[model samples]
Target: MNQAIANLASEADRAEALQLQLEAGETIVELDPKVIHGSFVKDRLDGFTDPKFIELREGLKTSEQIIPVLVRPHPDIKGEYQLAFGHRRVEALRQLGRKVKAIVRNLSDEDLILAQGKENTDRADLSFIEKALFALRLDQQGVRRQVIMDALTITSKGVLSGMISLASSLPTELIEAIGSAPSIGRPRWETFAQLLADPSHESTWRELIRQEQFHALSSDARFERTLKSVAVRKEKVSDEQIIKTGEGRKIATAQSSKRAVKLTIPTKHTGEFAQFLLRKLPDIYEEFAASAANTTSDNE
Candidate 1:
């Protein structure tokens, strides 16, 4: 994108540009959102949590759906359509209970892929993982690499093949389990994919991902949690050391391992200090107990 052109373009112009990359070059039209089904195969991110998506929804609430989405008449479903691009618009209108404005062309399966990929590419909208997943979907349909490259504007077939392979390595259940981790990029996903290749990590991966706390996390955090769990490189040895002072000191030692922890006050430094500790244990124990309960609750 030229800086000057981008700088001068209004929001409406951007929306039109974002949406109007129809592969069939069809005329735009107004249609009801309820009548349009999503792609036959899922090619886009699932959950609509992106801030831009939310903004689009809020914008639709206040204004008419000006930017027309690209849609094709559904082959199987009479009087229905399939979206090539503009899923965000479709989703927003669906949530708002509003009719969609679309360009209804009878696009071929391959054309639909092209149109969808092109529109997202023009907008730079798809995350690296999202693009990888979309590539995997296109490949599953037996779409040619040249077509995929042209659609996604990738010059390298090797990169495209790698993306599909990486995406295919992980189960669909696991992808949905993780949601769309938009904040995670290629390197992290590649690392996570490599970790998934090990059979021994499966149980640990399932355990980490299945936790309620995992679901409670942001998309990025969810990805991070999975990556950290089974990778031995991330395996940490927790510290255990005692601080000492000649007579008495405020210093204490907290010893921790992977599974257990202990806090100690050195008896060598202050003889008979155990009695003082005992006397203060009630207050200290209360605080510790409260903290432990909070940690447990957070984990749960």
Candidate 2:
């Protein structure tokens, strides 16, 4: 049994190695970075300023590029090529104004995505959300489920469906705003998705992320803050209560929630009652404040 397992593992290793092996007459050659374009379905969210990307760029400046990126002859453009994998390497080389070492092949769209996804799986650098978004983009382009599964190395249809659903639940603008929360996994993302089910909460999240202070935070911090903000908002609001008189007659309705309180009196004397309440509000508030201070002192 152990021998059989070893043989199977050996075959799997060989198969993976074969993917990077050169075909009959294929050879690695230097190509201008400008001529190599990104894949149709993006799999990464890290930008040029991302620390890891910057580290990659700095590392490339000191050592030779050991692996060649894969590219295919552009189907639409005559001389250009499209990148199947090694986007980060290509970007680093582009920034350095150096030629990219690549293996050019004639790959169809499906073939390209498969290669791209395989590289991502092997590297395992893509965050859960990035993979989810990548799967969503592939699905959006009408790629077959099997192809997406193979590309992402997903074994179960249920897992793939959940990923797509999670990505679809979020707004693209919101996701981009938060960036790729690398440390965040499915559970937190699912929790955030649940919070967003309320349309008002979704709106609040959108508006909160738009603020300058929110944008200043790191991607993971932004996600954490947003989740906490939404949760706090959820906790602050409670069911509206009916304000009644001593005899249990409903006189008004009061609704209170985070930062605001509203009172409604349905009687015809609403205007006069409102004026009377307005006149008494200062005294009522003063009395409440005095009581609150006394409670605090007693607690102390």
**lDDT for model 1:** 0.78
Q: Each model's TM-score?
A: 0.70, 0.75
lDDT of 2 by residue, 161-240 (tens): 99999999988788888889999999999999998877657778878977999978888998899899989887886766
lDDT of each: 0.78, 0.87
Number of clashes found in candidate 2: 0
On a 0 to 100 scale, what is the lDDT of residue 58 in model 2?
98
lDDT of 1 by residue, 1-300 (tens): 685466356555755664555534656677787888888667665568757688889988999876788888898989989999888899899999888888787799889988888877877657777788888888888888898898889999889888888899987777777767877888888888887786647888788777999888877777787787867532542444666668655556775667766676657765478668789989999999999999999999
Q: Report the CA-based lDDT of candidate 2 relative to the real structure.
A: 0.87
